[model samples]
Target chain A: MKIDLENLTIKKAHEAMKNGGFSARELAQAYLNNIDKDLNAFIVVFDDVLEQADEADKRFKDGTAELLTGIPIAVKNNILIKGKKTTAGSKILENYKATYDATVIKRLKEKGVVFIGGTNLDEFAMGSSTENSAFGVTKNPHDKTRVPGGSSGGSAVAVASNYALVALGSETGGSIRQPASFCGVVGLKSTYGAVSRYGAAALGSSLDQISPLGKNIEDVEIVFDCIKGEDKMDSTSIPDKIYKEAEKDVNENKKIIGIPRHFLKEGIDKEVLENFENSVNKFKELGYKIKEIELPNIEYSLAIYYILMPSEASTNLARYDGMRFGFLKEGENLLGDYMKTKGEGFGKEVRRRIILGTYVLSAGYYDAYYNKAQVLRKMIRKEILKAFENVDAIITPTTPTPAFKIGERTKDPVQMYLADIFTVPANITNIPAISIPSGFVNMDGKELPLGLQIMTPHMQEKLLFKISREVLS
Target chain B: MEIKDIENLAKLSRIELSDDEKKELLGEMDSILGFVEQIQKVETGENVSEAGDLVNVMRSDEDTHESGVFTDDILAEVPKVENGFVKVKKIL
Candidate 1:
């Protein structure tokens, strides 16, 4: 039977397999048939994809098939799948293979999901565009000339271009949401501890969260449910009791959404702003009350992110010395080995962030930059939590603009960082946020997709999914 | 940001940088530092608490995996491994 790759969801795929519409192997093959190399969406399509699907098929025959039994999914390269080449889109780990599965990967394996391949990402999941990837940039499926957004660019492209049913991406700030926005798909950046980070390569330990991107909100939600939970391996993973408590506190249906109008005053593209206004009006039309709330410290989110992210990143990335694993460059002595290995292995953006992190954490400048940013981060989080006391969720344009041309902002790092302005607040506050395809904008005679980001209070993923489905409905 | 500052940071970071790369990093770091400098002006209140609750999560002192169960797999990825141990340059 011919598979409808364009419109397939996890539920639909499972149903089809149960009803004898197609075998899991056939479904997996259909997605494999759609892989386009020029998009650079996948670094390596796993050779055992069909084998995994066949296992799913056997489970179906034995009446033990799970919801994700036959579902094919792409994983961001940072996530480990045991023995697979997990590059994280850096030359440093270009040939490095994961020795064990990430907690999320291990969970999905239990559910019998098909592993499609490892997707591309910015080096160590840094940078706003896939351009930072030493492998190559992942082009936007909508317009090949434009980027697919980064760190999770390849995963976003996988879902958008029908290379997989759904994909996993890791977010540090806007890594997951912005790419999902630009690719016109649904992406979720779960609350910081909602998902375990056991085997995913560390970026900013405080900010990084393994997330899901899918063609629709339901698909994203399904994948999230399968992978999210507390793990003994990841101490930072939130326990089930926290989510249960958060669920109890959530109001049944206030349907109130907060818009930080003061924060959206400048730097947003005109078309994108117009589209956002339309989304807010749509929420109003759907029996939702919209309030223009003030998050006083919200504007400083990107600045705070830049300071804190690098500090964490520099500390996290300090483990890439030559001896144990990954790329090794020998030099005259131990220090030279570290210096040469890192200098040559890491890409330009990775090097820049490391330096920036070192400077921020340095003796003379620590209090002014790093310490101050941490204090302000608390203020921003408090303000957001206060706003949530009145409103169910906060809404914003996922990106300041849509997918930009490949080389457009590569020359200017700050210009690229601005693309994440609206998305970083969610990460900073450790709140659950999602980006859903809102509408489209005509740019340069091509219709580019835009996304609306919805952020809810901590661990309120149920509310986040409910509101997202309503917004997309 | 000066070239000396960039050099110092690179030294602290343990990443080598050439003169040309240092020049490029100098300009880039200047702009990045300039952007992040905005937070310095904001006066956070004296009572600004830490970001989140800090809890110590401790696991029992027990072996989770069998000894040498993963030794081969772990050693396989190492750049140089000898006798089931990762080989490194001599310190002395």
Candidate 2:
């Protein structure tokens, strides 16, 4: 059997490099080889893979390697890749190259991290499944027929399929974690603004966080440490403050893990609930106290998120007119060209969201929809603040169900939106959430991964890691 | 709620939906809007929803910020360009 990097954590990969077993080029090439044929996971697998691999290999040989020097990483397309076509999986930007290295990409490059390629995502990180991508749908490696949970679908799938050892995935809601859970990999979405969003294709600016998807939690942590720092490029980035309270050893502690009793009330699949309970039981086995807690405003998160997220998406996506950087329509008038480019270029889901966003943010309904959601958005934040005060970290299912059949929910917008229900609460709160794979679905005897979303207080990422490591191990 | 509402919304969103699509969406969006309306019933307080807590994040007016480097070439690749500016279709 080929040596699967899925079994090799980042720490182990670093050790192998230290031992001279495989050079970084060989490691990166191995992943490239694995993604052969119908992996169907990448929008455009980097053409510059060999070049980056060679650079990483040289750095490894010179002994000037950072912790993740040799580990090949995929960056989500929405995040800037300098000259690469950073489409965010929308046709309008099918040719628009980024002007500057997004703050995260710049930092990672400085640390000797070789960016293998940009992974696909929902247009502007707007949807639950990668199907919303205008380029194409990214298939789950575990099961090709099912949808890879998105909008960070390509990022999670890249790591899961061992195409890249780690990938940077941005989450507005569970774009990173939900997809990571479905792909059976570890994904971390740091606190809102914890990672810089300087060059990412904006979704909900309030909720956007550029996080990491890795083969394991250790790999995720390594990438996080390298990229998680303030940058002048991102005005929203927070100054690094080592929170003392998070330094407490949580290996065997019996701290409160809040379970939002209302979160799983509706549309939860049987297998997901079973897997989630099994995960909680494992945490209990690890001696962590599980408390049935009430996040009262959690139910409204979906309603609030669809309104607020789309509102921001509308404004952010307005920059993608055909005339400037993207695929311009061949027409006479400006409005005609704009209409043709967007009408043909955008996918059904992206158009739907833009419409929803524009409707809510429009003059008459702005207060009724967008402004009301914002007021309730703070209420959701307050609910999390209150809940976290009572409990150290909150535990919930990352998504309602595991990977569904590719076309199962596509026809129904409500069903499609429901996939984001459990994940949207975290976006509402701007808290740190990590989805570590929690066993499998026993129903079909197929391995469908469940995401156990562990949310901690803002910037308490160390504590999130501590609990996540304990639970995952 | 009405075809007119969907039409109005479509115009606001800048997407041109056909009459048939508008008719279908008006019925569907009625339910979606009905669902959102329930949240307005929940008690909330005056809170300005801001993206981040960081305030006064303005750059200094000093000349030291720019190092006269523009190698990324983002502007050069624009599909329509003219004299260091991204050119767009003619505006009325």
- Name the top DockQ candidate: 1
Best by lDDT: 1
Instruction: Tell me, by TM-score, which candidate is best.
Output: 1
* Over 4 Å off, model 2: A242-254, A443-445, B45-54, B61-72, B82-85
Question: Model-by-model lDDT, in order?
Answer: 0.92, 0.79
Error of 2 at A132 (Å): 1.3
Recovered share of real interface contacts in candidate 1: 0.86
Q: Residues A1-473, candidate 1: write the lDDT tens digits.
A: 67888888889899999999999999999999999999999998999999999999999999999898989999999999998999888888888999999999999999999999999988888977899999989899999999999889999999999999999999999999999999999999999999999999998988889989998888888889988988988888999887788779766685989999999989999999999999999998999999989999899999999999999999999999878889999889888999999999999999999999999999989988888998998899889989988888899999999999999999899999999999999999999999999999999999999999999989888888888888788
Give the TM-score of each candidate: 0.98, 0.93
Write down the C-alpha DockQ for each prediction.
Answer: 0.80, 0.54
Cα-lDDT of candidate 1 = 0.92
